[model samples]
Target: MPTWLTPEGKALSCLEKIKVLNENLTEIRELCQEALEDAVLMGCDEPQVRQVLQELLDSLETPFENK
Candidate 1:
């Protein structure tokens, strides 16, 4: 009954959503990699940078929680 459950919608639902998600994740990973490299070049501690990134990922996993 949902708009995305209609025949036309079904044709463009899960697969399209997954494709977009994959694309976004890939791009985000690349950007994060670049950011990490830049931070390291700027004399930031790599381990600390990675820890912060992990914390950010953890925050994303529970967006409703006050991180």
Candidate 2:
């Protein structure tokens, strides 16, 4: 499990918040693994699929950004 961090880089101190974050990350990892497996089974290039997924994540915008 990774140490959940705040936007300012401090480790999260709340147990509940840390648990939620860890759970969410685990869920995302499982979903991504399934997607990658499906893509590979459909004859997609593994590296390309991974790269596309990385790009997709990189393109995400955080709605909580300070205005």
Candidate 3:
């Protein structure tokens, strides 16, 4: 996506930026989930687990849908 679009300094509309960001965010979310589950297996605290996971829920929300 970084390759497909202009550099962060280059021209892009707000909508396009949001689209790319959302795609990148989705990838980040999957990676976070995998890592968080590993932490659980390693016996992280329940509150710690929930606290760490809150970011993913935040990422899943957006006022606009790229689709």
List residue ranges in candidate 1 displaced over 4 A.
1-13, 61-67
Model 1 local distance difference test score = 0.77
Whole-structure CA lDDT of model 3: 0.73
User: Which candidate should be chosen as best, given TM-score against the real structure?
Assistant: 2
lDDT by candidate, in order shown: 0.77, 0.93, 0.73
Candidate 3 backbone clash number: 0
Better of 2 and 3 by TM-score: 2
Q: How do the residues 1-67 of candidate 3 rate in per-residue lDDT, one tens digit apiece?
A: 4434454555566786678787998897788878778888999886787776786577776687554
Q: List, residue by residue over 1-67, the lDDT tens digit for candidate 1.
A: 1233443445446767767767888888998999899999999999999999889888866446432
Highest lDDT against the true fold, candidate: 2
User: Per-residue lDDT tens digits of candidate 2, residues 1-67?
Assistant: 9887787888989999989989999999999999999999999999999999999999999888643
Worst 10 residues of 3 by lDDT: 1-10
TM-score of 2: 0.90
